[model samples]
Target: MTTPPFDPPSEADIATVSAQLGRPARNVLGIAARCVCGAPTVVATAPRLDDGTPFPTLYYLSHPAATAAMSDLEATQVMPVLQDLLATDETVRDAYRLAHETYLADREGIAVVPEIEGISAGGMPVRVKCLHALAAHSLAAGPGVNPIGDLALAQGDWSPLVCQCVDYNKDRASAGQ
Candidate 1:
């Protein structure tokens, strides 16, 4: 299939697509909760104490309601808005910061649990998982001037697999587990 032309996305466009898809204006707290606790499985594991341990990871759909709400036409219409968000410097920076913060929080929270194994550092694992999630979301959502690609590229080999895991987990969650 031929790739469509890339254009900047706008908030108005996002709203339009969201409306057509019946996207609800859920609160951030709700969104965060869905992200953390709604998934079928939530676990933190490590092979050894010194080894880097994966923290309490929960995966959920980035846009749960909208995923089902959006038709192909609506998604196509919203593509420009998504692209614009990806292309803007501020948006890119903000997204990275959010992902980074999420990672740090996950790491810190997992570190105190004591049940998890293989944890040498909490920060890096969190960052890795966050990046993986972001990349997976981007790829599934479709590519158009993605800013998160930088972080995914930095990790290279692992990013794709992590993204795949993110996708898998999200799918599993949406399936009602």
Candidate 2:
């Protein structure tokens, strides 16, 4: 496989991401996708952290709005519906398998961890576990790659085509984070 190009994150990007996540961003390799407002929506992380933790979630959702949207979808019990779609529809299942393959390729392109070799986040190729992880992959890899992710994104309130990020710095200033 050819080595994919990567854009390394800057110090400022790290700081902003830390603020966005309300904690330190660990082993972030690059910004996977950005919002219309220029803030990061998804981040590509290293397969292994500094402490040797094997984190399989390569594309991490960073935007608060997107996270909230996923949370809302999860609250509405959308995973079972999506899981049923995968179970009943061959085309959707095939596409989801492909998405899983693509996700594995992207993660392996960064670094391969033995424990997480066959595992992709968001219960790929089988179940709908985390909409956030799937949606992050959809945002990073674009539409048609992950059908479930795309569907979830379509069903959700937020859209990457439009900016929905809050003014984090301003909010922090007022709340004293």
Candidate 3:
């Protein structure tokens, strides 16, 4: 596999990306957590949109070592790259691929799987789905959204039901229930 440019982001860049994306500080911190944990995948606590739509804001998959090696400065520097990655389909795929490879390399013997568990509210089992499909559907259904739809699909094998679950969560969050 071709090793992509492996530069991490800088702190300022991280702030820039966070501001540009309108993501919360905790989500940014989650990215740092993934880097520090050296795990195959790191999921950010979903963020709410300005209108209070709960959705998977970002997903970082990479070798724990590569992530761990990333300094705060590097993470900042990498923000633009990540923004670009999310902006284009090809770059998103590249980013996912690179992260997956890095994650595998970091955890050689570990078996990591992406999952979505149902959240309970009002005594109802609120189903949840993978973030990738929801992102794809959003990109396709709405114009001017980021072009990370395909990138989301490329990361794993997700089902429509899973996508529906994600959508439900987003809707619930938007509804403020």
Q: Residue 32 error for model 2, in Å? A: 0.4
Candidate 1 or 2, higher lDDT?
2
Ordered list by TM-score, greatest first:
2, 1, 3
Model 2 vs truth, CA RMSD: 1.8
For model 1, what is the error of residue 93's alpha carbon versus the real structure, in angstroms, after optimal superposition? 2.3
Off by over 4 Å in 3: 1-6, 27-128, 131-177
Give the residue spans of candidate 2 off by over 4 A. Answer: 1-6, 167-177
Q: For residues 1-177, what per-residue lDDT tens digits would candidate 2 score against the true structure?
A: 433444578898898799889999999989989988778889898889999999999999998888989999999998999999999999999999999999999989878899999999999979899999999999999999999999999999999988766654566679977
Clashing pairs counted in every model:
5, 0, 18
The models' CA-based lDDT, in order, is 0.34, 0.90, 0.33
Residues 101-175 of candidate 1 have per-residue lDDT tens digits of: 544344444344355432322122222223334443333323432245343433343232222335644776798
Q: Which pairs clash in the backbone of model 1?
A: 9-80, 9-81, 9-84, 46-117, 48-118
Candidate 3 lDDT tens digits, 69-132: 2333233454345445544656555544443333333222222213312221111111112333
